[model samples]
Every structure is written in structure tokens, then in C-alpha cells.
Target: MHIPFFRSFSRIREPSIAPEPAAEPAPRLGGQLERALGRTVALLQYTADSHDALDDVFTEIDGRSRTVIEELDTMRTTMEQSRQSAQDKAQASIDRLSALSQEAIDSLTQLSADLDKRMERIGAVMETIERSSSELSLLAINSGIQAAHGGEAGRAFGVLATRMRNLAERSSLDARQVAKLLDFSPFRASFTQFNTTLAHSIGDADRRISGAFHSMSASQIDMAARMDEIEAHTRAIPDMLANARDAIERGRRVLEIAQAGCAEMQNACHGPRALAAAAQRIGAPTASGVSVLDSVRGRGVLRVAIEPRAWGMSFRARGASQPRGLDIDLAQAFARRLGVAVEFVERPWLECPWLLMAGADAGAAADVMWSALVPAPIFHRVAFSDPYVHFRYVLVRRQGEARFTDIGSLAGHTLGAMPDPAVPDLLHAHGVRWGRDSLQAGVPRLKNLLIFPSLTEVFDALCAGRVDALLLEQTMAGWVCAAPDSPWSGRLEMQAAAPSDPVFHYTVGVCDDSAADTMREELNAFINGLHSVPDYGQLLKRWHIEPAQVQPTLQ
Candidate 1:
């Protein structure tokens, strides 16, 4: 059943006629939403820029690493080529020197052989000359003897022959000394020893040079192999870099998705923020400071004023005889946090607001009063905390009756509602076409409207066909339309009303005093804190309240 006291006080627009555009400038709510969205967008942009900067840094590092690898590779190639060229030239020079050494050894051997042959020929000639000298000496001796036999005339001839014999002996002696001087046996032996030593020395030099070249060639091959490995490893670096770049690119894409999500959140916040702004404007007080927060002392029992008449709002549980509604649970949780026990003060819904306004000397009827959608006029007398929930109007009618599909359907039809402070004004504001100006004026009643004093009477009238249709909060109507115990259930068609903007934000109320301001601030802080917790959604779900409704309560 719909609670008469808890029904939304906002006037739902009649959709039969299109609303004409007002000449006034757009609401500040739009500007507020825009500024909020702009800030969110700016934050997202800043994040994207930061990501871009990081990407640029990584890209630079990758490029530098690549450049270093390339340079190393080029240097390795140049060094290998130079080393190979130098080794080739060195080997060629060694080969030429070895060839020149071999030629010198060969020429020395040939020269030694020629020298030996010439010495042998000279020795033979010396032998021949010696023999000839000997023969001449003998001949000279014979001639000297014959001359002596010839007597005095032959004496001169014999003297000449003796002189010749002396010449021949001297000549033979000189020839023998020349043959000894010309001897080549010792020279040939000495030349043979020198040639052997030169050949050995040349061979040793060739071996040393070849060994050096062989070692150098081995070292060059090992170095070339190492360079090749290094080059191959360096070549793999670009692929690794490409993989890193791909990872960074993927990260960038993820960042972009995050930015897009932020944008979506920004867009979604608009409707809620606008609704909050509009509701605030509607109930914003012109004057304040008539209440204070001292109504409740620290860690002491709290006096919370609430109406327990509603079915699912703030009523007591049937079996447990304990309070079990969204508002009651919230209040109990809040009291627990304060280290205080709750002192529930039952009061009528409409009169609950006066509890906060009670005088200090009167012992302040209650520390806080909730959860009401205070009318604009009440704001002059009380202060309200930030809204914790919002509600939209819905149309309720009998199932077989003409559907109350739009505002047009209700244009000339009679509507029923439990009397409330803001209902008349809201109805008028929505072009409800009421014949009467005020309910308390005691004027002739309008055939198009029915104001009951209680929800029971309203429902009784709805079931009795005393009213064509009724307006209620969407949640309340849904409950009523579905509840088996309610008379309107199954028989009533609860059609959702559109143009749901400018919804009412329900809040806890306080007197316009110092305590009221403090209490409001504290309540806002507590509510804000509650929204941040995971249990916030759990609490809403436990009470079957929509979690989305509480999100706009953020101060």
C-alpha cells in the first residue's frame, strides 16, 4: 500500500499538452553539470597526456638503444674488414720474404760450387809449372858439365849454365809457394758451413713468421666468430623493441578506454546533478540558524523522530516488532557509529518536522527528524541534510479502466492524493488544472481533485471508484500494484510517468539553528562516508531500494 505521508510531494506534469518553452535563461543546474563534466574531462585529458609523455620517453629509449646497436654492428663490420685486410697483406709480405730467403740460399750454394771448380783447375796448373821448373834445372846441370870438358873456351859457357841452374831452382821454389797460396780446400769448407748456417737461420725465420701468421689467423677467426655472434644478438634487439613498442601501444589503448569510461561517467552524472540542483533550489532556505547540534550529547542516547506508519519506508517489522525499513536501518547504523543507543520517538509524519524545531528549554523533542522531502515553505522553518534518495511520480488506475498512460489521460479526470504541504502547489505547477486555489480556503471543491486525510482513505476511495486515478511515487505504486494484500494490487495498473526530471530529494530535517547546521553537516559527512563503502550497496539491496537512488546524495 502507498504511504500517504511518504508519497512524493512534487507535482507530476500533465502530458496532455506540450509544455511551452519558457523565455527565462536555462537553469543553473545545467551550468553546474557542465562545469562538473568539464572538470572530469580535463582530468581524463591530463591522464592521457601523462600516458603520452611516458610513451614518448619509452620510444626515445628504444630508439637510442637501436641506434647504439646499429653503430656497434657497423663498427664490428669495419673492424673485421680492416683486420682481414691487414692479415692478408702481412701474409703476402711474409711469403715474399720467405721466397727471397730461399733464393739467397740457392745462389750461395751455386757460388760455392763454382769457386771449388776454379780452385781445382788452378791447382792442376801449379803442379804442371813445378815439374817444368825441375826439368829446366836438370838440363842446366848437364850443360855446365859439357862446357868444362871443352877446356878454357868452354869455361865461359859453363859459368852461364851454372847461373841458369840457380835461376831454375829459385823459380821452382817460387812456383811451389804460389801453389800453396792458391789452395781452395779450406775456403770451400768455410763457404759450405756459412751456407748451412744461412739456410738454418732462414728456415727458423720462416717458421717464426709462419707461426705468428698462424696465431694471428686463428685469433682473427675467433674474433670474427665473436663479432658474428654479437651482430646476430644485436639484430634480435629490434624484434624485442618491437614487442616492447606493441606492449606500450596496448597500454595506450587501455588508457584510452579508461579515458572513455571517465567520459561516460561524466555524461551519466549530468541527470543526477541537475536533479539535485533543482531540488536544492526548491527547498533552499532564505534565513537560517534557529537550531543547534547540542540536542544530542556525545555517546549518549539519541532521540530520533520518525513516523512508523508507512509499510516499507520506516515502519516496524510485524514478527520482530523491531524497526526494519531503509530509514530505520540507516538511523540505527548511524546511532551505532556515534556510540549511542537509539531512542525512537514515534510521531505523525506531517508533525515530525516540529520535533527538530522544539525549544532547548523544552528539551528538544528530537535530535534529528528524517527522511522527508521538505516543501519549499518548510525550508523557512527548518534546515535539511543533503538528500539520500530521490523519487519520481507514477500514475495508478484500475486494470480494466482506461490506462493513465500519459498526462493527457488525466487532463479532465479526477485525481486523488493524501493531503500534504507541497502537493497542491506541485499539482498547480504541473498544470494540473485545479478549480480551487487552496485546500484551507474553504471554497467550493473541485470535481477534478480529491484530497483525503490518510492513505487508507485514499486507497479505499481508489478501490471504490470514487477517484479516476491517483498519483504516487513510482516505488510506492509498484509495491501497491504488486502486493497481494493491498486492495489495488492486480486490480490497478501502475503506469510509469515520464518527464521525471525535477524529482524530489528526500532528506533529514532539523530546526534552523546552530545545532541544525552542525547536524546537517554531520549527517552529510556520514552519508557521504556511507556511499563510499561496499556495504552501501548491500544495505540498499537488503532493503530492496535502488542503489542508484542513493548515489546523488553525495555532498
Candidate 2:
């Protein structure tokens, strides 16, 4: 797709004097018109493709975000389940231990009471036996005294008394022995033994209790492990729930984003529909005219083009292919914006009078020329529009090259420059050693004047390692070196001039002709509208054009 370098402005015709009706009968919309329609179609297709790609990338990002959130939710739920299970198992163990401890205490208390009662019974029996023995011994002593008084007959009685005494003595002895045997005095020892047995029994019971403790501990450990296992298994429930919920949330967000993007796409689609309607208003076509729209229901053609005045430029890396300048891009943008077909025309400069006049000689000349123009002299029969951009200029050099220490160092190398009015006066004042013109002067001189139509081309040529030094603007210089992360950026290099002077303004001009009156007015009005309007400022700022007044965004 070749783009026009310039619009032909040959043989100026006199202005139309009177109000006249449209002269020509509209042809069955010609090839030019069809070409315009075709461009619109191509643009719409491009927009659709771009939007589809963006939507796909967005979907991928959304999916990844959704997955991460879902996993996080699952982790949280799993942690909660494990904590709760552990607490429950600990509580149950405490309850069981409490019951076992109480039961052991009760058994020990009952055994202690039984031992006390048995000791009391043994003491009572021993007391009763001792009393009986004492009574028998006293009776025997009294009987023996009576027998002694009765002499011979008393002898028998005394014998019997003696026998009785002996018997009583034996009985007393046996009773004493029985009393000793029953001697509840040792009941203390029996009680002590009972206490010892009770202690032993209590100890056995305590040992049993200790055994229960071990069992309880083991049970608690097993229960804990079981609880942990349950927790591990149950974790899936909450985790699944949380994951589902998070995934649903992510899905919802993606849907929202999709809706927004869809709305943009829909709006973009509407442009072509409106354009078609406008074309019809001007008597172009209808829905019946387009077969594609009839079947697909995709009416309207969306055409998107950067504004023609945009000065965005791109440069290659340190070593690479020749970077294309902005000339072709600008012309293409204009043609596309106007719904016209695009053509690329190369020219040495925008202001080549011979080039403009040459259209008469060669049928294939420029439709529009996109390049630089300094404040071309007023006498040149060309009237210009207000400047779109203005900037301070600098002398550029290859990166890491020898520095131009003094103005004199610029003498030997070829100097790159665009046509500017103030150059001669500035150069003379600075005593800078430089060139005049190599092509025209044909001077076999050290300084070779290199002319560039626009600084963009110069920077591009710089990237191609074409020129040693060229005049460049600061903002553009920054963009050339900016990394890929930068927006509206490129790659290039520059150096400060030993003497930086008089800034330049960018503008478009047309040869003074009354025949081009209508187009000229349109172009002029577009330029004048830039002053108060903020969007105009936005355009320049977007291009990083300096000397532009910065303003707040429209409400």
C-alpha cells in the first residue's frame, strides 16, 4: 500500500465567483468511492481482529486469577476443619478422665470404712472374756477359806476347794491366756495392719487409676489421630465449597469485564452502521446493498485511524534494519480517516516546488505530501496554517561517539538539518564549522549538507547509522531511547548542540489558490480551533509536542 508523499497543487485556478449547484451528475458510485468503502471494510476487519485477540488474552488472565483465588479459599477451609477437630477430641478426653478419676476415689473410700468396723468388733470380744476370768478367780479364794474352819470334814471340803481353786486357777489362767490372745491391746496392731492393707489396696487402686491414665492418654492420642484423619477427610467438603464459591466469583468478574469489552466492540461496530447511514444520507447505499451484512447481521463498518497530525515515530535497536519514517504512516492515516484509498509517494522534501509543479509533467504525482516545513517565506505564494507543534532543537550524534567539545569540532563531519529560516544567522553567530549544501553546491568540501524532509526520518536514518549528527527535539530524543515498557515510545540517540537556539513550529500549508478555497478554509479552521479546545492540546501532548499549553481534561 504506497502512500502519497504530497497532494498535487498545480496550475492554480481562479476562485468560483457565484453560488453554484453541484456541477457533475453523480456516476454509479465510481471506483474511487468503492475504494473508500473497501478501506472502511478493511479497517473494520482489523478492529475486529484486534478486539478478538485482546478478549482472548483477557480471558486467559481471568482464568489464572480465578484458579489462584479458588486455591486460597480451599486452603483456608481446610485449616479451619483441622483446628475444630483437634479441639473436639481434646474435650472428649477430658470428660472420660473426669469419670474414671471419680470412680476410683469412691472404691477406696468404701474399703477404708470396712477396715475400721472390723477392728472395733475384735476389741469388744476381748473385753467380755477378761471380765469372766476375774469373777472365777475371786470365788475360788472364798471357798478355800470356809473349808479350813471345818477341820477333818473340812479336809474333804478343803480338798474340794483346793480342786476348785486349782480348777479356778486353771480357768483363770486359760481366761488370762484367752484375754491375752484376744488382747485388743494388739487391736491397734490389727488396725495398723488394716490401715496398711487399706493403704496397699488404695495404692493398687491408684495403680489401676494410673493404668487408666495411660489408657486415657492412649485413647486421647488415638482419638486425636482419628480426629485429625476425620479433619483431613472432611477438609474436602469446605474446601470444595470454598473453591466453587471462589471460582464462581472469578467467573462473575470475568463476565463483568467481558460485558465491558463487548460494549466497546458493539460501540465500535456501530460506527460503520452510522457511516453507512451517513453514506446513504449522501445517497451511497442501504442494507440491501451489502450481501455480507444481510446474512451476518453485522451491519455498520468501524474504521479507526490515528489522526493525520500525529507525530508518533519508531526506531530500531542499536544495530538493525533501516527504520521507516512517519511519512507513509501519516498519508495512510489521512486516507483511511477520510474513507479514501491509500497510496505511498516518496519525495525529497515537503516544500519541493519542482515536485509540485512536476505533477503536470508526470501524471503519477503526489496527492498529499507529508514532511517538514520551516516558516517558509511569505513570498513563496504559500499560506500556512497555525503550528501544530513547536520544539527546542539539539545537535544529535551517534551514541557513545566522540563529543563535539567546541563549535569548531562540527566542521569536518556531515551535518543533518531540515530547511529552517533562522539557521544562517544562528550559525554565523556561533562560529560553528558546518556545511552549506552538498547536492546543489557541488563543492568538494569537508562539510556535506544532508537535507531531511522531517526529523523523524533523520532519527530513523540515525538508527540506520546514516548521519553523524542531526538536529533533534528533546521529547523525541527521549522516546527513541525509552524501553519497550514505554507507551508511545521508540529507539534512537542524540547529543546536545554546542549552541541550541530558536525553536521551530510544525504546520501544513497549501499554495495560494482560490480553486482550493473550500479545502483551505477547512484546514485553516481546524488549525484555529486548536487554541481554546482541550482535545487539541490532548493531541499535541499525546505526541509529546512541546510549547503546547497543558490543560485539565474535559468534564
Candidate 3:
């Protein structure tokens, strides 16, 4: 005999990674490239008043980004705590259910022992009945013998003997029946019927007990199953909450980074702006001997709003050689072509007028602002030259994340971004909700946001696995991701804006200053000539900012 003879074999499956989906629609793909080109144009547009200011803007953006990252981390921690609490509660329930099941098992075991004892008691009663019946049969035999000895009285004796024999026979039969059933007799001679009824009653009790036991078992099993499910849910919840907390911490980090970056950018912009101001004050002589390019000479001075370097831009796919984010470039070219010196000023995210005097009538600082101003800025303040460029805000995530199809998909994930009053307000405007369970159409995809100070930190955290994604304009994100020497190249992607979003535009800002009439005429004329000029168009194309599409073969 072989005490230990066994064969074991295992067939295991190899682990696999997730695969990318089929290519997107041709139009969307082209849009991604076009947006990339826009970033290059944004860079070309930055002409700060001083190097210090340029540096400050970049530093500020970074500082804010770092702060945001920290916030994301905190949010993740909170979520984990919540999940752990739920798991503990579920575990306690499971323990209690197990104890109840054990109690039921013990009760059943005791009932089995009691049943055995009852059977033994009935056996003893049957033994006594058997002994009594044997003794009665002997007496009958003796009575018959005595009757034979007596003559006339023998009849009575014989009768008595017969009666005794009959009683013995009946007693014996009763003992045999009691032996078969657990004896609980009604008669002194035998307890067969009573014992049989007792046995039946015991069986009924056992059956009832079994039924109750079975019910209890079922209930315990169900309770355990429920606890298992609850535990699983609770476990997952902690991780989700952890992710959310991490996102918040990441946001805080972004803010810190942006704050530091802002300080640096401010230093950089200061020197550059001062230099420009000094040059202006000293009146560096131009060949034309114009202190400032007066409107009378040609078009006039065009005030260009420069998006700080901290914000940055992208360089998309190559076409004809040109810089990207070409609208900013065109604005500069338009200013130069009109024989006007460009006064580039840094503009705030929302209020460009504060940076430059665009809409004011009397104390206006700059006649026109170029950067990316919406139509509202133009319509309310002054007429726009035209919409020179378009942009979008996009969400960026890890490279292999297929779970997120759109920004809305981020609802389950921790989202890190700078807290812009405009963002939440915009969501509120479109009836977007602000709770974890609250989801509806037209709402921004992420209700749980880890707000940061700047977008750069958001990107940093995403790359570092601190947060799931970063939010920014598609045009900027796309270009920066593809730019040469950019670390994010090929590792980043753009998410399309939802239909509920408003169009992002870059337009010319105008003012009602004395130079308004001349400024308007020159700007319109400059735009008409901008596209046809080789240098201007070449600049735009160089930046990969051209908006054209070409289809690719699908595999």
C-alpha cells in the first residue's frame, strides 16, 4: 500500500495588460494635432514688460500646481478612512452570525443525546413487563395442578387456572409490543400504546426542532453572505476614498508649486518689463525717428496681452514651417505691419482689462489686446477684429487608462485642478450638481474636485501617479505634450470638451480711446493682409497651428 501517492498539475493563465481601443474619428484626431500647434503660438505671443514678470508668471503657475497636488493627497486619505470604517462594521456582523450558527449546532447535538436517554427508559419498562408475564404463566400452570387434586372444587380451580393463563398470554403480547416501541403503558400489565405514542411525540418534537434548526441555519448563511458582500463593498470604498484624498493632496502640492513658481515668474517679468519701460522712456531712436509709432504714420501701437510663460503653450504636428498658437503671432505681426510698436502686457485669467486699458474711454493704457479674449470682451467693451484662434480646456490622465472616456468619467476618480471661481460657477450655471451621488446631464463630469492653484502641478501629479488627471485647455495641453524636448511628449493626451461647454476663443480687445477710429481701421486692414503674407502664414504653420485635416488608413 502506498501511504502517499499523489500527482499534481496546474494550468495557469498569463497576466495581460489592457489594450488601446480603435482609433477615434478622423476629425477628432485632426483636432488633437491642431490643438497641439496652438501651444507653440502661445509661446510666441509672450513678450513681457520685463524678464522678471515672465519668470514670476512661470513660477506662480508652478507654485500653484504644487499646492494642488498636496490637496489631492489629503482627499485620498479621508476616503481610505471611510472605507476602513465600513469594513470593520461588516466584519462585526459576520462574527455575530457565526456565533449564532454555532449555538444552533450545539442545541441539535444535545437533542440527539436526550433522544437516546428516552429510548433507554422505554427499554427498562418493557423488561419489567416481560418478567411479570413469565411469573403469571407459572402461576397458571401451578393452579391447574392443584385443581386436579381437588374433586368438586377442581372446576373452580380449573376456571381460575384458565383465567390466569389467559392473563399471562395477554401480558406476554403487551411486553413484546412494548419491546418494539419505547414503552409508555396505560395498563399495569403492559405499556405498549402509551410508549408508542410517547415515541411518536418525541419524533415530532425532533422533527420540529430540526425544522427550526434548518431555518436558523438558512438565516445564518444568508447573514454571512450579506456580510461578505458588505465587507467587499466596504473594502473598495476605502480605496476609492483614498484615491479621492490623494487627489486633494495632489491639488495642494500644485498650489504650493504654483505659489513658488509665481514668485519666480514675477521676478523674471520685473526685469523684462523694466527694460521695455526703460527703452520706451529713453526713446531709442528708430530709423523713422518716431518716438512711438503714431497712428498718423500708419496703423498705430497694438497692445498685445501676453499669457505668462508659466501658463505655457504647445507645438503640434508639422506642416509648412511656422510657429503655433499663431493668433498671438499674427497680432504681433499686425502691430508691426501697421508701423506700430507692440506693448505686450501680462493679463489675468479673467480680467484682461486690469492688465491693459482695453475698454476704458479716457485713461486707456493700451488700444487693443491680442492674447485670447472671448467675444464678450469685444462685444461689451469694443468690437473685435475677428476671432483669430480657438482653444479648449481638456482633462489629462495616465497613459494606459481606458476607464476614463471623457471628463465625466472622472466622477469616480479623484480630480485635481486649480480652484477657479468661474469653473464651479459655470457648472452651477448649467445645472451641474456638486455631490458624489448626484449626477445629471449637462453637469461637469467630476463633482469631487481637488482644486489646485495652477495646471502645471496638476500635470506633474498625474505623471507622478499622485492624481488621476489634470484639467487644462485642449489647445495648450495638446501642443505641450507633443513639443520637442518636452517631457510630456507622447505621454499625454487631450480630452474633448463636453457639448455643455462654451466655446473658448481668442479675439482682439478694443477701447474707446482717441485712437479708436484709426486703431479699428488699421486692425481690420491688417487682418485682411495677415493670411496672404508669407511670413505671417509661415509663422502660423511653423507652430503647427493650422487647422486642416487628413485621413489616415485604419488597420
Best-fitting candidate, scored by lDDT: 1
Each model's lDDT comes to 0.56, 0.43, 0.47
- Candidate 1: tens digits of C-alpha lDDT, residues 1-555: 222211222332222333334444335545434433443333334334434544544554465456557756766776677677667767766776777678777877887788778777777767666766666766666676676678763776767666776767677776776676677687778778767977786777667667667766775676666565454334334433443454445334434433433333334343544334322222221123222344354437777887765444576534566755667878888878767788777665644554553311224357787544444453335667777766666667888776567544666456777535445655655655544343444333333455553455566667777677887655456555765654456777777656543366567776554435767787888877876888877765554444224234232
The segments of candidate 3 whose C-alpha lies over 4 angstroms from its true place after superposition are 1-303, 310-328, 340-343, 347-352, 358-367, 377-383, 391-393, 414-432, 435-445, 450-453, 464-467, 497-502, 512-514, 533-541, 544-555
Looking at model 3, residue 399 earns an lDDT score of 71
User: Whose TM-score is higher: candidate 1's or candidate 2's?
Assistant: 1
Q: Candidate 2's residue-wise lDDT over 1-555, tens digit each?
A: 211111211222322233234444234334324533433333233333334434443453454345446645655565455555545655655665566566556655765676577666656655654554565566456556665577664656666566666666666666666555554555466567656766675666566656656655665665565454344323223323333443344334333323332232223223444334333322223332343112112322211111122134322233434322332333344444444554433332322321221121213223223444445552143445455456555555666567654334555454555544454445555555332222334233324334444555555555555555665554455444443433224444445443245556655444333322443455456556556767655554453434523331210
TM-score per prediction, in order, is 0.41, 0.32, 0.41
Winner by TM-score between candidate 3 and candidate 2: 3
| Per-residue lDDT of model 3, residues 322-418, tens digit only | 2235545665567667666655554333334332321112222344656545554212234566544455456676777777665556654555555
Clashes of 2: 18
